[model samples]
Target chain A: MIYLRLFWEFFKTGLFAVGGGMATLPFLYDISDRTGWFTHSQLADMVAVSESTPGPIGVNMATYVGFLTGGQAGGMAAGVLGAAVATIGLVTPSIIVILMISAFLQRFRDNRYVNGAFYGLRPASTGMILAAGVLVVKAAFLPDGLSAFDWRLPVLAAVLLALTNLVKPTKKLHPIVFIFASAAVGILLELSQ
Target chain B: MKELLSLFSTFAKVGVMTFGGGYAMLPILQREVVENKGWATEEELADYFAIGQCTPGVIAVNTATFIGRKQSGIAGGIAATLGIVFPSLVIISLLAGVITQFSELTWVKNAFAGIRVCVCVLIFNAVWKLGQKSVVDRWTAGIFAIVAAGAILTKISPVAFVLFAAVCGIVLQTLLKKGGVGQ
Candidate 1:
């Protein structure tokens, strides 16, 4: 039963987490809320581990979740199962449509109604992305919950946001720079206190 | 065994180093797979990227598996994927149990806060860049907008948005092609 649950949970996550790895953030957040599989802090840790790991952040996180819930087998089950199901789910629909409509792909590309729908979707996805950011901010910065918001949290956010812009044109700069910089500031603040 | 190990390490390097995943791995993947080692050619990499995108489980993972499979079949896929996942498993296993305790540490908390903020920026920048790639023309722009909005607005699943977008994109592309859109 637990195995089945894990399969379903990740299958659901993979099937729906369209925008690839980062897109999984929203679904994983949902799972965290739905099942007490992990806490918000744990989710942040998952992000850290996922980010620092070798595979896709989404898969790594999924494997971690599976391992936490059911152990190694569970982890592999979740990773492979979810990935397989999700990938199939993602590909099957499009492939079928494409193959069936192979003759008409070009004309179908220009429909005005389709255009309008997509135009609306962009801002929507952007909003989802922003919402995920806000959630992360709350989880990472205000571990004590949002109502007890601290100036330090938002200030830290602003500083990083500003610093992120600095890495400009040099986007390839290692993620460690931000991590180390943030760690340094954090360490300084602690010592000062 | 050595070939499998290389597959694992190469992807591990990609997983650890990259701030943004998926599309972000493209250049690094090319560098490692194509340039550093003669693992795969530029064309093969491109094919892998296309297949990876169309498939699932983080572009990085999919590509790793594809290349792995290409090099050594099923064993290679498992090996490459294992390489990708090993780090996350170890790191999360260590921290997940006691993360809240660490957050209670002032400096630790602050550092995380800053990292979260940085991650937010990274996520945004990556999305924006991808959005540019995804929105090629008026039709594609529409599909992207529709998918983004659908993802944001309704409680529709994210998978739905992608599938729907692809369907719409393909359909639009098909229709337009009939109408000489592709040309």
Candidate 2:
């Protein structure tokens, strides 16, 4: 049942999550909320892991969530199987859609209706991604309540934002480097405290 | 057999080297699939990328599937997909197994705390970039505003939002065409 549920959940994610890896965030957040299979905190970790590692972030997250859920359901063996199932579930839609597109590539590409739909989807997907970002911000900075607000974390986030954006030299640096550097900063902050 | 093997290996290399996200895979995919393997031309790869964007699921997987299917057949599509995700499955499973075990530790928790904030920033950055590209006109800006607000305010499924948006898009386009206004 767990494996079946895993497949079903990820199948929905794979099928409906148009756009790219980041676009899957809302679905993943929904999955976390609905299933309790993973926490928001854990979702952030998965994002970190997915982003820093090779491969598509969406696929990485599906595998990570599946592995964790399956491990809890059975053991490491189930975990591996769950990872495969979830990953396949994630990509199954792409395979099916691509196969269909390949058969009628010209017509599909030239269809004005398809283009218009995409034109609409582009902004809508961006909105969803923005909403997902807001959710992450809430989860990370306001998990408990506003009363327990931590200023240092926000400062760290701002610094990272600036480093990745406004800063000249650091702007072009890969995100993995920032993630690793943040990890070290986190550990050091903990040590200081 | 040889064709499928090459398809798998080529995509496997793509899978392993792709860092960040699907967009990050573009250059590597260009090199492997176009320049080296000659599976797809530059324009063909661009088409795949465009289609992959609007299609469901991961763009990288979609592109790989397209290239694979083009090369061999449906079997090649499966091979390429499997190859692309194979690295993710193995690598994520291993990391998840190890991370779950260590997540309880203080250092790990703190590290996650910092990483979580960093992730928020990254997601925000992505939104900024996506918004720049997608929210080009008044209609799209309207869609973005409404969807953003609705998504945050309501617990409605994201799937519903996407479907509704697609329908709205088609309808709006029809209306514009009837009105003789250009998109």
Taking all chains together, each candidate's TM-score versus the true structure is 0.56, 0.64
**What range of 10 consecutive residues in model 2 chain B has the weakest lDDT sum?**
B41-50
Candidate 2 per-residue lDDT over residues A1-193, each given as its tens digit:
8988999999999999987787889999999999999899898887756655778999999999889899898888999999998888888888998998887764586787876776777788778667766766876677567887878888998899899899999987756577678778888896212
lDDT of 1 by residue, B3-49 (tens): 88888887777666454345445545655676677777654453344
Candidate 1 stretches greater than 4 Å from native: A1-172, A190-193, B1-3, B17-75, B92-105, B181-183
Best by lDDT: 2
lDDT of 2 by residue, B58-139 (tens): 9889989998998888999999999999999888877775665554577766766666677678767756755776777899
Q: What is the lDDT of candidate 1?
A: 0.55
